[model samples]
Target: MNREIMTFDNVGLAYRRSLNPFSEKNWVLKDISFQLYRGEVLGVIGRNGAGKSTLLRLLAGIIAPNQGSISKERGIRSQLLTLNLGFIHKLSGFDNAIMSLVTQGKTIKEAHELVAGVIDFSGIGHLMDHSVSTYSAGERARLGFAIAMQATPDILLLDEMLGVGDKEFKVKSGKALKERVQSDQTAVLVSHSPTTIRKFCERVLWIEEGAVKALGPADTVLDEYEETAPTRGNSPSKTTTATAA
Candidate 1:
């Protein structure tokens, strides 16, 4: 059975220009309204700088919409999955793991409890104690993903995670991501590739200029998006065949 987990009603978001506080604010997402059902992997597709990431931030509650309303089920947790992951370069990977948990609203003690699993899943091994700046981008992504996965948020927001990690770790992370969404969990993924959306997402939300262009079955939405989105050529986007561990 399916249940509604989140809803957006007449939502509008805009950011004020730094120089002109009194001037017109730059609108990103406007009049956005949608319903997210439990166990549904929703895919959002848009060109670069189309307010897609901003939408994810809105969904994660990392930022509030400037107008309208976004309501989620009480006590439900959400996290946005970005490759950058936003780690402090000065902090050691081990320390950052705990910090990540704490930032997610977990208590210090709870963060400690999850640190071991995060480290293990990250596969950072002895280098876990090294400063995050010393590690490569892939390593940091591993850390970020590991921490978020351990938190086990009810909703996972993904921003084209296909680029995450090294070649080897990609398989592991991809499988892990697949398993999580395949369960009774809800996820909203932003991607340029329709293949990723088709394989993993239950529904598709096509956005243009920060507003929803189409919202329906993945195939139906993607069909129109591909036809209209000149940037997204007719060529099929390719993905990997990663196996679960």
Candidate 2:
């Protein structure tokens, strides 16, 4: 019997304001709990300041929960949550790839080999020698995804990284991601776009006010979220924000 791949038990996160040490802690997330089984793609969605990114950080073990605990069975590969995650702007793309692999605990030789493949896969063969700082946002995203996919983690966590490339690249990357998910790689995608979520995720976790507001099949949850979500026609100002506190 295969055990669950990841579990969040009564997880909660709170931060103390620097100005007022004696003041009550500002709770960012509370009473969060969920289990992600192997080969499942979970979509995390929420309003602005709802702690969607915070939840992903906790799941990645980047930060410890303030109250409960998060557990992972093993073999989880976390990808670049943001542009600054894996590469240094001054470094070459090839160098950044190697550095990312080394950070993930690969040997120097292994990192070198993996970097070669990743650079090739990125279709930025000529640009590999250039400094990463010179690359555009789309190019950087490609490099990050290539490095992450090369590691072949059992679980992949992506945060609004799908639309970073050109249409052709997006098509190619989408196909690649689909193939990976088909091959027993569980995924967690956090995005504000409904179209993107419907394209890849089978399950959706709608978060609001730092808590899970709803959880179930992707279409169902997305429908409910859309209905409840503030729209431009009804609320123009709300559109500017991704999540609400």
Candidate 3:
């Protein structure tokens, strides 16, 4: 039997429309319920503004649901992979990398030892000593991606972290992600690319208008989603309007 690692029971999240106490709440995700099994790769797919990223943030415990509950297996650790790694602008890329690792629960010495691998993987060795403010957006993203890949989490939450950087680096990161996903790592991957979902996930969750449209075998849900996906200039059904956040 598959071991359940996490369960979402009628999960809902909302934001206040305004600072006023009387302002209405805008729900980004409503009544979402799902089960994540250990050692399985689950895919999340939806059109823009469908709250995909918000769902990952919820799973990573970065935010709490306003209603309902999300229960995780004891001692389970999750990491959400994003290119916008919070780097101290005044700090050197190397120092920022060390800080990131240390905050992720590594000792300072361990973080220092791990910084070399991050530098090698990011291909930003020459700029490692330079302040992050001096690095280009692409350079920062590369370093961020490298640091995220080094983390070992029970659940890896990916928000299209694949195929990043220059063409060569994209290939390298893709290979690295594939190795992680193919292992015993349990992951929740959100992507617009059906090909990616089909390639990596054992199951798929399709969300529309901040609610589940379908959840089942990946191919089944993907086929249904593709059939209904709006073409350019066409608007989808009116649902919650969030920034895919």
Predicted model with the maximum TM-score: 3
Model 1 clash pairs? none
TM-score (all chains, Cα) for each model = 0.87, 0.87, 0.89
- When summed lDDT is taken over every stretch of 10 residues in candidate 2, the lowest stretch is 236-245
| Model 3: per-residue Cα lDDT over 23-59, one tens digit each | 9999999999999998888999988898899999999
Clashing pairs in 2: 47-243, 47-244, 48-242, 48-243, 48-244
lDDT per residue as tens, model 1, 1-245: 37888999989998887877798898999888888988888999977777789999999888898899999899888888786677888989988888778877899999989988888888986778899989887777788888888887888888877667777777777788889877777889898998878988867887777777677878877777776655544322322121110
Candidate 2 lDDT over residue span 1-245, tens digit each: 13588888889999988778798898999989888878877888887778888887887778899899888776665554554455788999888888888877788999988877797768898899899989998888888888877877667778777777788878877888899988877888888898899988887887777877777778887877787655522322222222211
What C-alpha lDDT does candidate 2 achieve relative to the native structure? Answer: 0.78
Clashing residue pairs in candidate 3 are: none
The segments of candidate 1 whose C-alpha lies over 4 angstroms from its true place after superposition are: 105-110, 229-245
Ranking by lDDT: 3, 1, 2
How far off is residue 14 in model 1, in Å? 1.1
When 1 and 3 are scored with TM-score, the better candidate is 3
**TM-score of candidate 2 against the unseen true structure:** 0.87
Better of 2 and 3 by TM-score: 3
- Considering every candidate listed, which one attains the maximal lDDT? 3
